[model samples]
Target: MPRPTPSPRPRRLGVAAALAVALTLVGGCGTTSSSGNLKVYQQEQFEPGETFSRMFDASVSQTCEAARRALLSQGYIVTVLRPDAINGSKNFQPGGEAHVQITFNIVCTDDGNQGKLSSAYVSATQDRYTLKKSPNSASVGVSAIGSLSIPFASTDDSLVKVASETIPAGVFYDRFFALMASHLKELQMDAAVD
Candidate 1:
């Protein structure tokens, strides 16, 4: 007996089913992550002595002044200086079209003993930028004719901030604190001598 041939309808349906499954998987790939990223705030521990603050044996004004000098010595531009607070920033161009800016903010508070003991709390933020180029557009209108729009072939380049974050506590903070301490010690010695 001769064998019968398979029907064309079933073969076509099989191909269609396979294609649908493949498309469903490919579509899922382009989907974005969930909106639960905002929950990252829950990760903050706010632990003490981790990296953002330290104590100094001086008045609030003295501690702030020492921080200012330490920043200036390292080529930071001091933007705000006060008895209890200081703000400074420095720019860096490591290489290529990348640029970095580090801004330091310091707050000094009297620990106790009529300003004889003080504490310094510092935080540094790093902002990263990259060069970006955008195309320019030109438009001209003539009374004799209709309005004309032209796209300029030239590119306009600018720096765009890409990322910003507060520097975590580590050797970077350690070095800064060490420098500030040295400056504070110098100030104390000068006062003692005078």
Candidate 2:
């Protein structure tokens, strides 16, 4: 007869023990660490510097035309127009009793490549007006049956422009200049097509 085979229970126990020891030996070779070299950095904000493009390529006249388009796109009414300057205004009613407006004036340097903008200064002013409501009653002379009376309701602005503030030459101007740049590009493209 062949040698008696080992019991299945003992064989299974031996295999399990060997596997646990192997895992322990393999795992013990590596060191666990908590501290890491990872770094956290915040994003840099967009700051308009002194050299920001207030003056750019294109002529004063063409740039003014581009400015007109830009302002119109932004719902501004172009009031005064000149070869080297533009003035526009936008209106807003934030509340039922208040009316606000912003006036935009852009003056471009007149020296450039006939159609290129060399330099420009843009200014924006914010003005607020309030609405007033007053009640008045007027009585006419007695009529045949009853006295004639009229009540008038009116709301009017003081017609005074007040508290105007000029916008700074920072992000607002940067954005305006960027839009003007794009508009100038478009004008060029349009001329090329023509």
Tens digits of per-residue lDDT for model 2, 1-194: 89997779988999999999999866654433234322222222346654333766777777778888889988999999988888999999888878889999888776656655467778889998777556677787766767777886743445345467766567877777778879989998998899
Clashing pairs in 2: 57-117, 58-115, 58-116, 58-117, 59-115, 59-116, 59-117
Off by over 4 Å in 2: 1-53, 111-117, 143-162
- The lDDT of each candidate is 0.89, 0.75
The window of 10 residues in a row where model 2 has the poorest summed lDDT is: 36-45
User: TM-score for all predictions?
Assistant: 0.71, 0.63
Q: Taking the tens digit of each residue's C-alpha lDDT, what string does model 1 give over 1-194?
A: 99999889999999999999999876665453355343345557778658587888889888998899999999999999888999999999997889999999999998999878998999999999998989988889989997898899898989999999999898998898899999999999999999
Q: After best superposition, candidate 1 residue 90: deviation in angstroms?
A: 0.5
Q: Over 4 Å off in model 1, which ranges?
A: 1-39, 135-155
RMSD of each: 8.3, 20.4
TM-score of 1: 0.71
